[model samples]
Target chain A: MKVRVTVMLKEGVLDPQGKAIGHALHTLGFPGVEAVRVGKIIDLDLKSTDAQAARAEAEKMASELLANLVIEDFTVEVLG
Target chain B: MKVRVTVMLKEGVLDPQGKAIGHALHTLGFPGVEAVRVGKIIDLDLKSTDAQAARAEAEKMASELLANLVIEDFTVEVLG
Candidate 1:
């Protein structure tokens, strides 16, 4: 099974990198961009065949190593 | 409008970060993880209201600045 884990900073947490990207975009003539938030997309190729099991395993991976629980939230999706 | 741009390295490109993450996962007991690829997910808050126009603008941003055409491929999605 294939799993995708998207890890994003929690709302209210400051994202300096995102701000920098937004600033760069504005400098490059994209004035309509109001805000930007950047996150990580991790795709995992798992040996599991079951979607349910894959999702569970991916969630574990996200919580354990992919995301910081204090400032980040992650969503795990199984693409079997 | 809300736009999501997912930028991923082109196939066959070296991804040391992803490999490191995979190795770390393996070390941390995720033996079922066969492979890992990492990408970026960028969320943009745009002033545009039209979904069609937002998609076009986001695609333009991805091509112009968000992704390296020589090494990365990006997908743009507008969330109206």
Candidate 2:
């Protein structure tokens, strides 16, 4: 199975990297951009074939190591 | 309008960060993981109302600034 985990900073947290990217975009002539937020996408290839079990395992991985609970939130999705 | 740009290292490229993550997961007891790839997800809030225009703008941004074309590939998705 293939699984994906997305980890993002919680709202109300400042994201300097995102701010810098938005600024760079404006400098590069993309004036239509209003805001930007950056996050992590982890794609996993798992030996398990069951989608439900894979999702649960991915979620556990996120909670235990992939995310900082105080500042970040994560979501797990199972893909074929 | 909102747009998401996902940037990933091209296949065959070395990804030390991803390797480190996979090693850590293995040490943490996720023995079922076969491989892992890390990428970026950039969420953009655009002032434009037209989805088509927004997607085009985002693609331009991704090509010019968000992705390192020599090593990274990117995909742009427009969302409401």
DockQ of all candidates, in order?
0.95, 0.95
Task: Please provide, for model 1 over B1-80, each residue's C-alpha lDDT reduced to its tens digit, 9 standing for 90 to 100.
Answer: 99999999999999999999999999999999999999999999999999998999999999999999999999998877
How is the predicted docking of candidate 1 categorized under the CAPRI scheme? high
* Residue-wise C-alpha lDDT for candidate 2, range A1-80, written one tens digit per residue: 99999999999999999999999999989889999999999999999999999999999999999999899999998888
Evaluate residue A14 in candidate 1 and report its C-alpha lDDT on the 0 to 100 scale: 100
lDDT, each prediction: 0.95, 0.94
TM-score of each: 0.98, 0.98
Per-candidate fnat, comma-separated: 0.94, 0.96
The candidate 2 chain B region of ten consecutive residues with least summed lDDT is B56-65
lDDT of 1 at B54: 91
Model 1 chain B poorest 10 in a row by lDDT: B71-80
DockQ of 2: 0.95
